[model samples]
Target: MAKLKSAVVFLIFLTSVLFQAQEREFWLIDTETQQKKIVKDSVSAVKFLDSLSKNHFIFTELKNVKKVGLRTEIYYDKGQNFNEAFVQLSDSLSSELKIEKQFYTKNLDSLKKEINKKYIDQGFAFSRIQSKYLGKQNGKQKVELTVVKDQKRLIDGFVIKGYEKVPSRFVKNIEKEFRGKKYDEKNLLAINRSLQNHTFVSLERPPQTLFTRDSTNIYLFLQKKKVNSFDGIVGFGNDKSEKFTFNGTLNLNFKNIFNGFESISLFWQRNPDRGQTFDLQTDIPYLFKSNVGVNMNLNIYRQDSTYANVKILPAVYYHLNNRQKIGLRGTFETSTVMDSLYIQGKDYSKKGIGIWYDYTEPTEIELFLYKTRIRAEADLLSTHYSKEEITAGQTRYFLLAERNFYLGGRHYLNIKGESALLNSENELSTNELLRFGGWNSMRGFNEESLFADFYYYGKAEYRYLVSNQAFFDTFLQYGELSSKALGLRPKLYSFGLGFNFFLPIGLMSFQISNGSEFGNEIRFSDTKIHWGILTRF
Candidate 1:
């Protein structure tokens, strides 16, 4: 009897444990077709039904959920109301998400994604969306979406990772453009373009964004660039006697030496005819953290014992933005004949005021300098001839524009035009006329060889990029020159080919070109050849 009781007790305990360990099975039934499918658990049944709602069955409802023994039954009404679905926004998101308060959509899943994207782009990086079905209403399925916006991020400032010595003011200028704006991809890309091929600094990599509790900060990894440069060019050509002659040019530029984005430049050139030119300019972009800045220029030109001219220009400008500026400039000029016997030139003094504008848009590729650039100035002056003792009113206008167009891969079309006019009712003297022609202007002629009262030239260049640091180009130029004193009105054309490549020392350039008047035959003896190099540090 004792053995029987022990077996019976063991049997009872085993039965109870088996009953407790039984798994619950779920069955989903479609009310219309009466088709049933078995799922492992309640969660699986709900997920399968939700997917059907995303298809044409917009009004899908879990009408009955009943548990019996170890099995559960889920009855869903997959209503065929595929026409429209309505979205109801939560109180917190009503203003932001309610353009057409009740949107019509066939798929609830896509609508949820659309709403999520809207929040993400508006600085809600940590926002979450939860959708709940509220059954069918007015022949459409109604759903409520609640947004949990964890944080809204705005740009606070910038953090420099490398090249820490980069001027603080330069970074401030960049920050001022987008600070306090929403932290999004659009603003991030704008920052990248702003720093691309910058004069003083270049990006080591794309910028990064750091998120904090209070703000979003941009982290810049930069490498300081060698923008200060020394450029020299030497030219060889035949003089009137068919003898070889040499002319040279020197330019020295210092930038950001004081860490203020300021610059100083000195330029001197000697022409084959013994004419010489010198210029000095200084620019301070910002004054005591203000937008106003100053620029000063001094120039002296001597024309081979014929005449000499001196000019001084001082100006102040306001920063319109990072890439453009407008300013007012004052001019003082004096000219004298080198020899009293030189009757073609006269002694004169001029005082003038002018408005100037400058703009630059850097190219997307570092191989090129700029995508577009413009610099223009117009001045009105009162000129007094010391010998004649007569005062005349004069107007001077100058313009330079450059644009580069990309021609598919590794090719570019660069168009450049420059024009200058010195107008007066009185006869203009040789000492006061404009001089142009050189590697910087009309490439085929000697430096400062062409003298004119008014001139305009346009250049079209085709460039093939060999590498990041090398390119080959051929250019055609055509222009007109007018000079009343010389009694000349001539149409001229020039063509040139050049190649620039980078060496260990610097960038080296070489070109050979020739120019002639409309009726003159091109001659090899008239060709001008130039060799130049630019070293930046």
Candidate 2:
């Protein structure tokens, strides 16, 4: 008897182990017909229920979960009244979704999520979505969805750190752009980009957003940068006698010296042909805590033994945004012929009012100057010729565009184009015509060597970055000009190679270039060489 009992107990233990090893099956049942369908596992069971729910058969309960196989019961009915639930949405949003009085969606949960996203974009940061079942009514499931827009959050202000000396006006301008606007990712990114390439400051990192009870605040960590600079360039060229001559340019810029984001610049240049230029400009980006600003410029130009021209320009501008501005400028100019026998030059005075637009986009890389820059101006002036005792109307237009495109790795392409046109019914004198050449314009030629009433030029430079502070570049330029005084309409081309590298004091630049008329052969004698340095303080 004892042996038989022990054997019985061992068999029972084995049976229990086998039963536990067997996988349990899940089933979905139709309550009315008592029909069932097999489900693979718990995950599949949940998916099956979801699929049925989408088809208006919602699982009411899980039955016999711990028995031989799991079972769930579902009832079939028409889904929720989406039209009633959508009544809570704004008219614009409801129209955007195209929800009608008989609106329906197979995936109700997805619809709810999409609706929630729309609210979030509208500054409803803490919005909630809730759904409830009101049981079957008229052979259809009665359901309700509620959108709980807890608090509408707007941008309250900014909290600045890392750089405390930032111009108050600059901060205020940013506030004017974003304060009281929706607190969303799009606005946050715009705020970040506004500070990315600022002339006076740079972001230490991306901007941060903080949320409070009913308002949002942006946190900015900025670093003050040195944008003021002293730049100089010296050129070696041949004079009319084919003798080597030295010419150079100087630029001194002071920016934000008093922490008001103002700028003052002085520039002087002398060409090999005895021509000289002097320019002084001052700019106040903001005055009296307002977005309106003022700029004043004074320029003097002397053409060797020919004529001298002096110009003064005053402008008032409104900031459209961080990267753009539009302004009205008044131009006053006077010119005097040095030699009475010089028939080609003229003594004249000009008064004009014009509209101008400027745009600048800073490069992502600190080593590069700008990603894109554009300046355009249109003016109508009244010109008085002292020698001829005549007055006439003149229209002038100017445009300059520059862009840098990255081609992966360390390669980049810089393209620039500039054009100017002077239109008048009266004759244009050599002194009044535009002059362009040399390192800053049509490299390889003498400074201000080419004169024209209309001109346009394009330049393309390919660069290979050697380091953050060094680069090697080769450039080609092509242009055409019309000069009535010279009776010439000529096309010109120039090519050059240059390199810039950083030194202990500043950046050093060197270039060798040659240019000639399009149909003329290039000669070694036409080559121009330049060396320059730029220091920031």
Candidate 3:
């Protein structure tokens, strides 16, 4: 974004005069030396032309003498018998005209001053302009330019490494975005955005390139930095009946395959009403590039001074893309509940192992000028649903997609659509299906707070940012997921608003909603608004 902005600025600089002003003659004044030499370098020549537009010759007041001629002997020798000159074609001596000329002349001198300062600014003692030829014929002039430029310049190139999840050829395609280009640091920064658009990379503000290396290579060297992510959440919270505590997830992720395609993290949350939770997770990717990964999770919970469920699960997955993935997963899980002494059924289901493959693809119809990512998945019984002799045939199909448009600088308008289905004997239900609501989802809703079976929802979020200062986000969600067993909902709706403060201190968020369950009768308290703070290291 920064790089694109600068390119726009540069283009505007070139067009500012051309956009509204008439062309003029080149008033040749040799360099201030005993044997003045014309500029011989393309870079310097182009810069000199630009500087001329800002020099005294163009923007300052012409001397009081009313003659039109080039000044040859030192400064402003208006009375001239000169070797070279650029006389104004029409010598209208009106004060208004002179005032305009003076304004232009003053601007030119200012530009010259800036050009002289650029050398020092760039750590260069001397700048030699190399294109020196100029000619005129048939009342038209031709200025010479050089094809090669040898000016010393510094640029942070785009870096690529450890992309094991993607084919090298695909990475090569992204590398082409920066190769052999002029190292305009500002433009490079903006073009780096292409990384976020790619389906494979996790979205984040990319790291800057290390400054020391070969600046001229087809594949430039850009050393990447480590990544740290913070998750902030506030919520009405859960079916698991957790409290109204602020929940947060801290993720420190990596893109380079150097340390291997793996990630690890620790999590803890507390609430006044509900119990608390401490969980740990680890995931490994590149399981054959079809988006396969291994997920392990263990959670310890307690409330009212008693032990809650201590659940453990290890799941292997195969996801095709950020929008979709298919995996044949097997998990060994066990649990213990806090208040289960009088409970008829076990607080948790014993270990159940199964393999499921799922997939998603975008539908052709465009919404918000974009198509929805369509998907479908089916899981057959690789094993029993439990130690008991019963097997579950699970299948689900879904379509979800989002598109955004810029409202102004930092403010953006986002639109989304989603739908899904679930079949028999599946332990995962509406409560487990994830949607856009928490950190990285709906800024105001709790993480995984609002989703149900066989449902459809849409959301609009307006996010604002102030460069390095902070970012603010607010969104509205209206949709529900339903399931028959949980009496969840086939028809549900919620519309809410929320915000986040993305600052150096980390992230803070708050959200509120007024809606009901997916059923013939909508219930209240079934909905509420909330707030939270979260960060990571």
Candidate 4:
């Protein structure tokens, strides 16, 4: 009797366990679409169906989860509140809004957020989602969600703090453009970037929102900082031809003149190689209220004993977007080369239409530990020199890439490379050929000491930040200049240690390095000590 009883107990226990397992099966249904998804277990069914209420369109619902036999059936429907609210906002009215359905649960969540954002971006300031379970439907369970799109706000006016003398018309125009439109984050960011580019003001902080009874307003707070309107340098240097030299430059910049987005600049430089140079440039952005602008430059260059040139460039440039630009220029030149033993004096007039493209992206400036910046340009021109007896074309290409990474709190890695190709007709003159080997180029050689048709430069540095604005660095540079007719030696290499200071005025660096030309024997007598200031911001 005891053994029989024990066996009966074991059989009952097995049956109970199997029954509980069978109760876990379920089905997930989309009533409007008439589609069903089968779920194998109760735990998974509950989790998935519960997620649907929070994961569908802005106001979607998973209505029910009721067990019938071994299967749980889930019921889904649209929320009436959201459906009816949007109906008033649209031209067509329906009692129930057709839910924008989503397939994959993974993407359904993202789509729901995007839908809510559309209302928020359009000034529905109090829009939100609310979900709840509403018992059973047809022996299954029910859930409902309601979207509350509370109020629609319109832009009233703008308040700009700082710079009190700004014209009211200018403020009114800016406000008129956005007064009745939707307030969007992206548009605000674009405006900030544009203002920074033209006005030299940083708008990294977002505009503050102020609410009134009828609508909303935006307040832009401006912080004024040092503006780079004037820059000049004074220095002495030696080049390949001259053992000693005098150099100085003076620049004047007048920006946003008359509040019409205009820039005028005048530059004058005196140096031994070029004697005296003067340039005047003017830039007008958004010319005639369009996406294109005109730029004019006039340059007068004179070398007392050697040569002189007067060049004029007038270009119309189009901005494809923020990161890319293109321009077409008509150039005119008149020149005279002094008569020397190897060449006769000549006067020439060359005219050409040149096209150029520039691309720049500096996306990693704010990232931690690493950063990257890229710049590239290409220009082509074809001209006829009447006195030189050459009908020729010139092509110029330049590319630069820089990478910065922090190895630790202090150690940093910097790698930079630059390559240029200058091509012209075979009968090009002495002043037209390309040259390298300077503090800015090969680093340890005399200025303009290497002539080439093409050149490549690479630099690598390991640096330690001594302060917020200063760094100590060790660097190596390699260069290769190739020429066919000039027979100039090609390979140059250098290594050095330097300290760099990044001041508000510019970047200043000092370095001492030894350069070597590799040939039958390596000769390394060029010990160069270089220091300079550069302010191209």
Q: At residue 421, what lDDT does model 3 achieve?
A: 65
TM-score ranking from best to worst? 1, 2, 4, 3
Instruction: Report the number of backbone clashes for model 1.
Output: 0
Q: Sort by lDDT, best first.
A: 1, 2, 4, 3
Cα-based lDDT for every prediction: 0.85, 0.82, 0.44, 0.62
Name the best candidate (by lDDT).
1
lDDT (10s digit) by residue, model 4, range 47-148: 554554444333445454455666656676534322111111222211234443211123423544665776778777767855454554443334344568
lDDT of 1 by residue, 469-514 (tens): 8999999999899999999999999999999999988889999899
Q: Model 3: residues >4 Å from true position, as ranges?
A: 1-137, 141-191, 194-261, 268-279, 284-388, 397-404, 416-419, 425-453, 466-468, 471-473, 486-489, 502-504, 517-527
In candidate 2, how many Å is residue 501 off?
2.8
Point out the worst 10-residue segment of candidate 3 by lDDT.
71-80
Q: Is candidate 2 or candidate 3 better by TM-score?
A: 2
Error of 4 at 278 (Å): 4.5
In the range 384-450, model 2's lDDT, one tens digit per residue, is: 9986899999999999999999999999999999999999879899889988899888897998888
- TM-score to native of every candidate shown: 0.77, 0.74, 0.48, 0.60
RMSD of 1: 10.6
Task: Please give, for residues 165-230, the per-residue lDDT of candidate 3 as tens digits.
Answer: 444434444454445444454445545543433323433445444433345332323333343444
